[model samples]
Target: MRRAISRLKPLWLVPILLGALLGVLGVLDVVPDFVAAVPPPVIVTAIALGVVLFAVHPRAEAHQPHRMAAPVRGRWAALNTPGQQLPSHGSRFLGQYAAVDILRPTTPATPAKLRKAWRNSTPQEYPSFGEAVYAMAPGVVTATWSRSRDHRARNTWQSLVFMLVLEGSLRSVAGRAALLGNHVIVRHADGTAAVYAHLRRGGVAVQKGQQVGVGNQLGEVGNTGNSSEPHLHVHLMDRANPNAAAGLKMTWTDITRSEEIEPSLAEIAKQPEPNAVLSMPRNGEIFEA
Candidate 1:
């Protein structure tokens, strides 16, 4: 029961509560008689919405020991895990993916103060803001995009609410360039494409159709697209076009840990673990490449 609740997003809970509340009100005669016709439709709509939300909810995948070359050098940590947190809720096409954000271990994991006060901050404030992104696997460059603006970090309640309500349509409104921001798609050797997203302006170093080896420089991480801070957003898709592809499972190689785990456990006062191995880094766990 605890685990299930953890998987649910707060915004998704609203409609569910509304549906149940309407049912209770109808039973208690809390509403007007003219409103008698309201409960059934409202209840049904809420149920439908509930099903959609559940269906679209980010997927928590069973961790497989995936071994891939380290995509970035130096010490870094993982946020939004495939272990419990569904990185992104959309699970169809580019949506059915387990996305992970990689940032340097030295960066601020959360807003230093109120979540909203940092809304106008710059990406350079974070350590991972300028770190270079590397190829997850050897493959040819399939596609690239770099048009989104790296607006201030959306740490305010207002921006969070707005993102919950309308962020879904950002990709459609701004084209594929909107959500991922300055991303590159490499046709990975394992029959999937590695999407390197949220890169800095002019950070991309490889071109489309160019062959790259594992660990090749793709670009420096930046605050672009739908990102709230600077970090590398990556996911594996079955096809070159994320919109038409399904997300594939990925396992990291060459991962190791130290005395501390997670950002809050201990001040990760050092770099990532030097010897990389195959494992999943939990939300706060740090790893060095």
Candidate 2:
């Protein structure tokens, strides 16, 4: 009997279940009048949720670069982007050790994961993470925050669930550290501030008011603050504070170009291969040197 059923496609189960649900609804007399006169928000919501859960649900076919081979050398693990992987120096320090997506790359790992409305996936395009992530034309570390314990992956998920639960509960924020948890804000020579968020706990290698070069190691990556995974979140802003700052226009040197209005996750997952290099903005676009 088991062997006999194995040959069947089992496509009829869907209609059978749907039919049973409708039959139960009819017997309950919930929609005795007009049948279609009123909108069934419950049924509509269930169907919509089912579709979304099916699409974003984590499965074997879903994109997951974390399970891929460690792309970089060293013991530090790298941050993951949509299509590409940035070497964090092979550090498992993020999960057991420490580390830290975009506006929302739309993590399909689970239904409760945050949905990214937009993401900034501009790869620095070098052999390793050390190649770029520059000093932003030189600056001093005006302020730094270290010493937070690296939240385990389980904790990360718990924090995400809490935030999603309270997503619309807050009216506005007067001051919230959740925006930039455990980070360093360096003021560039041109007065532009580069904010690096979700760094490793007690891994900040720099000090307050210390002048450092472009390639100086500030700290190990960690899952601190409001972050989903282990990756350096760098975005230029005019102000030093995360709450009051607006992201600035940033550019890099010696990279390949593939500009998209809205780049897909498939493209970001392909990065970090050995010797894979890419540049942004094409040619002739002069950025702050």
Candidate 3:
């Protein structure tokens, strides 16, 4: 059942299901005509959601990632991005569904993992876990939040499911702040705003009105918000409010890609491989700056 729901999530079945339920209620006399009259709205919502779920494909063969300089200094994972993957495949209501979730890959197979997925180790133990998060472009700091507590890193698939369920419910009650923990927003000069979310607790290092430039340190990555592990989430938007912002393209400077299960510090030192230059990494593709 859990797997089924997870699979259905990308399809956005919940809204569609609710819309169906509303239709059934209208026809079965479960609700009054006043309520039934609102069925049009529900049907419209379902149709719109369907288009969002299946119609848009940012990473489609015809599209390409807009490359830029690397945001972080060391190794990081480029998994979900509207420019790189199907997960963030559309531009809809806001940019919430269109942001990139960045992280440094440390796994059960890494030397840091020590051959175990989880054994009471903290995300702080990994070299890339608390690495400094840097500014990608010069911008004014528009918003900042730094109070959500850092939860334990979900080191295993089993634990990750639990983390998702717990965070899912808590988010409904806590709102956007719940999904994006200690975060910072920067409105760039080009009319594009960049958001750095899920920073360490009290890890925010800049003031709301401070000016920041490319390579400026904003915060340290940590396990906060809707993350299962420590990572830095960054995305570009046309609006400061993610709810209504339109997502923009992303590209990283120099990087080297490797599929090594356990990359050594020495191996990571030899970064920006000549062949790996100027490429949008596929999912699970390891890259270092």
Best by TM-score: 1
Whichever of 1 and 2 has more lDDT, that candidate is 1
lDDT for each residue of candidate 3 in 33-80, tens digit (9 for 90 to 100): 775566576668775775456333222122344455566886666555
Could you tell which candidate, 1 or 3, scores higher by lDDT?
Answer: 1
Best by lDDT: 1
Q: List, residue by residue over 1-289, the lDDT tens digit for candidate 2.
A: 3222211213322333454466688788774566446467755655554433322211112221221111112222122321222222121111111112222222333222234324321111111122122343467997787755544332234445655575312211211234345678787765557766666666677788999776666765565565444445555554454333433333344232333222223322333444221222211111121
Residue 53 in candidate 3, Cα distance off native in Å: 14
lDDT, candidate 1, equals: 0.65
Give the residue spans of candidate 1 off by over 4 A. 1-66, 85-96, 106-113, 116-119, 168-174, 264-278
Ranking by TM-score: 1, 3, 2
Report how far off residue 12 is in candidate 1 (Å).
23
TM per prediction: 0.67, 0.43, 0.64
Cα lDDT, all candidates: 0.65, 0.40, 0.62
Worst 10 residues of 3 by lDDT: 54-63
Give the Å shift of residue 44 in candidate 1.
Answer: 16
Candidate 2's displacement at residue 64, Å, is 34
